[model samples]
Target: MSGAYLEMRNITKTFYGVKALDDVNLSIKKNEIHALVGENGAGKSTLMNILSGVYPYGTYSGKIILDGQECIFKDIKDSERHGIAIIHQELALIPYLSIAENIFLGNEQASKGIIDWNKTILKADKILEKVGLREASDILVTNISVGKQQLVEIAKALAKEAKLIIFDEPTAALNEEESDNLLNLLLTLQESGVTSILISHKLNEVENVADSITILRDGKTIETLEKDVDDISEGRIIKGMVGRDIVDRYPKRDIDIGDIVFEVKDWTVCHPLQDDREIIKNVSFNLRRGEILGFAGLMGAGRTELAMSIFGKSYGSNISGHIYKAGKEIHLNNTTEAINNGIAYLTEDRKNYGLILINDIKDNITLTKLDKVAKKNIIDHNKEYVVAEEYRKKMNIKSSSVNQTVASLSGGNQQKVVLSKWIFAQPDILILDEPTRGIDVGAKYEIYTIMNKLVAEGKSIILISSELPELLGMCDRIYILNEGEIIEEVDRSRATQEYIMGCIMEHSKEGKK
Candidate 1:
């Protein structure tokens, strides 16, 4: 391979006359961990798609050079033959298949129309060892955790003899320890002389591992910063990304604490399939008017179960809970009743539960409350259009028009549409579960601003997040849940990452006793 491993020169791509990438140039050296950062819709994914042959050679104007030779990639298979592999943000693994089968799904171990199962298992074992995964080769991919699935992806790439691997938001769903392990694996790959192009929204992780950083804004290349030569700090990177300095990530708000507005008592939920196994245990909490109460916990700790159970029992089976609004008991048997009772839940899995991807922004925005746009069972198209446009602008959704399909929009914009759908319902209490899971920092700041604005208008928010720093920054009070139970509650002024974790550990030890 040449000293400069790959280069894309003057790449320009357009979609339906819209310039998705305009005169973008990028170069990467061999064995370096290069990072790409930008706001949503800034052409990061578009550039990578072109490189990986998702967009074929003639579809876009660009010159791709690898190992000092110009190349034309016809499809993803062509790029793979040239030692290129991409692991997307959403993993592409079949759940029912075993680890060995998943690793060699297309390129199987076969000889003369006969498959060699033994060879496949043996080879998969070796590849998994290279990726530092110790799982059995025959274990089903569905049975493994997300972090292990990520390693399996890397192992698959290595099986293809990939010299250059691209990771697109690989740690978006992983917890802190899982993220650390994945980053360390990247370092190990670098030591083995593998080149990596990391596309991530987490600025801190980028700053931690990247040898060089490239910034993109609005389909154009901003600048590339070398770690040893440039500033390369998180703040410096943010300026290059958003084109301006953001003074604070979390918006400032005055505390106007009011009386208790919503409460749940003795809430318990059982697993949907395993009826006897309790997923949530007798949890009680209260939210005041204009308050942002946060639930912090590790993965599978039942934070989501608690939120869903309270939101009309959308998740669990055999649920038992007493919900009170202004100290009066109320019953919410279904989702419509929950909304009618002034409660809205923005689910964590937006693509699955929170949005109808085939629908347009206007349809999604008015989905929860179509009655507002109708008079005597007759729809008002003009009124709907105006309302959708107003929210499209208010949420700063980056789309060509409100008629654009939700699936065509970026992750952040899709999230904004979900928020708009619920906010239009005018709920007194909003439950947001991991509201900023896969979006960029600029978009995260915008969401935080919206949260501040909502609470300022006397709306209560129940935020369930795996991110401790976020809870500490934006919440008025924080509750730590461990093993399906609330272990401790801490005020925002007194909550720290160390302290919350300490409480969980203490509770775990006592439970063991």
Candidate 2:
């Protein structure tokens, strides 16, 4: 244990009498990529926060030994000063500020109340090159792509002289290429003698890059497997995380797809800020009753743009589209009109656009369909509680009670609340955008089962996902989108990962020509 670079002994944290981490123990080797994995609410984040001083030393019961010395970190700065840095899933950078400024936000290059801009830029340039980011240090963070933003986060850590770096779900938002680049960067960092701890749900990436793996379940350490010694498989890791063997990743559904229930024809939308730039280009698609239709694409392929523009024009401008329900054309100029006309959209960004974090689950569940629990604009508290409780049980949302704030719930449970709200609205056509993002395998299966039930009840679904396997397993038919246009459509029997990717590549090459 003395030879280990970092060690946490008997780490325990609680929230409102609930134990988040119960006497957890972890050991990390020097200059190795260690992976921490678990289901939602499994204390992965809790442990990392304690290590990085987000929760502070006094708030948690633990002995953090760094480089053979017991360290007590009072704040994030304290940990940073000790060569510890953390990069969260959400990149923490000021959008309007230059990369150089963001890298040294608090620890700026200043002397006697005067900032040295040249020094900051030069230092940032050196770190950015280390992280393989080619963008100029003076470039604004807002203008860079998400992939570059990830690199910027790592560069910031390097600037802090971090010897031990932790990344929480770094690849969750990135596409395949971006994810590969980030994972490779972690390996590169490891080769350069920097120790890394990656917490992710993507088992494939973990297996690829992790030198050792630690599994947590229900706030307790289950097991730690060394990649070189143990038979580390995705199935083994999943069983340790969920406490059961999931025979099937997707639930079986009785396919009984009916006639077309919703159709969009020659739909086109221009960018909101750039008038002449098209975001969705003459896209045409249809959803049949009792079927899940999936849209597959790489990042920025306009799947979200098409869904949002159709749902009361929530995105883009200069929209031109023809939407039909049950063979009758409908006009929806706003979100209210779209909802009233039996259209519901579940946004990918559940925290920002989907849920009211500060509000209780009951309030959020019944927010979309207030009329159901109200009489003449007056809400009945008793009825609302009953409705919320019903959905809580139905969705299997793990919380203390329906009155629990949405912010306090896990990512999976929060997504369930969003689904409950939309289901209560009684929409005929539901657009689910990245419905299972950032959740565990078990949670993903639960969501897939919910989709099956919804379609079984004759409700059509428009699913948009970046995961090719998810689309393949869940959709009856898959549409490939590239550069804001639909390139090909394939039936479930014909859609393979290779076929879908091939379509995208073919179309991309044509677009370039």
lDDT of 1 by residue, 1-513 (tens): 236789999999987568889999999998999999999989998899888988999999989999889989999999999999999988999999999999998989999978899999999999999888999999999999999999999998998999999999999889899999999999999999899999999999999999999999999999999988899999999999999998888889998879999999999899999989999999999999999999998887899888888888888898987999988999988899999999999999999899999999999999999999999988788989899999999999988898989987889999999999999999999999999998988999999999999999999999999889889989999999999999898998899999999998888899899
**The candidate that achieves the highest TM-score relative to the unseen native structure:** 2
Per-model lDDT: 0.93, 0.93
lDDT of 2 at 111: 88
TM per prediction = 0.97, 0.98
Model 2, residue 77: displacement in angstroms?
A: 1.3
Distance from true location, Cα of 270 in model 1, Å: 1.1
Per-residue CA lDDT of candidate 2, range 1-513, in tens? Answer: 126899999999988678889999999999999999999989998899999999998998979999989999999999999999999987899999999999998888898989999889989989988899999998999999999999999988998889999999999999999999999999999889999999998999999999899999999999999887997799989998999999889899899999998999999999999979998999998889999999999999999988899999999989997999999999999999999999999999999999999999999999988989998899999999999999999999988889889988888899999999999999999999999999999889999999999999999998999999999999999889888999999999999999999889988988889
lDDT of 1 at 124: 97
Score candidate 1 by lDDT.
0.93
Clashing pairs in 1: none
On a 0 to 1 TM-score scale, where does candidate 2 land against the true structure? 0.98
